[model samples]
Target: MEMQNITLSLPKPILHRVKILAVQRQSSVSRLLTQAVEKMLEEETEYEMARRRQMALLAKGFNLGFRKPASRDEIHER
Candidate 1:
């Protein structure tokens, strides 16, 4: 895949932490950032897909082909 370069500005403390994480994980900060962004996008996409599916199910509604039961007072004498 083709790759491009971009610039980002992060606080020194955050950058230091990212650098430490990179060392611990044996990965570069660039790769870590890429993975983070990819994961965020994937989660958002999955959430949207689930939301749309739920909405579709709601639109279709549910039916058991049975009449609803009567109220408690109707079924039992007080």
Candidate 2:
């Protein structure tokens, strides 16, 4: 796969924390950021797919072998 380079401007405190995390994990900041981005994209894709499936099911509707009550009092009856 082809790779591209991009520059980001972050606050000083945030950059410091990212650098510390990189050192603790023994990985480059670039690699850590890439993994984070990949995970976020994957989660978003999964959410969209699940939402579509749910919408389809809703459109199809369900049959529980149920019928409407004969009277409103029957529904409210305890």
Q: Kindly report which residue pairs in candidate 1 clash with one another.
A: none
lDDT of each: 0.96, 0.95
Clashes of each: 0, 0
**What tens digits encode model 1's per-residue C-alpha lDDT throughout 1-78?**
798999999999999999999999999999999999999999999999999999999999989698988989989967
lDDT of 2 by residue, 4-75 (tens): 999999999999999999999999999999999999999999999999999999999999799876798887
Our tally of clashes for model 1 stands at 0
Q: State TM-scores per candidate.
A: 0.76, 0.80
Q: Which candidate has the highest TM-score of all?
A: 2
The top-ranked prediction according to lDDT is 1
Those runs of model 2 whose alpha carbons end farther than 4 Å from true positions after fitting are 68-78
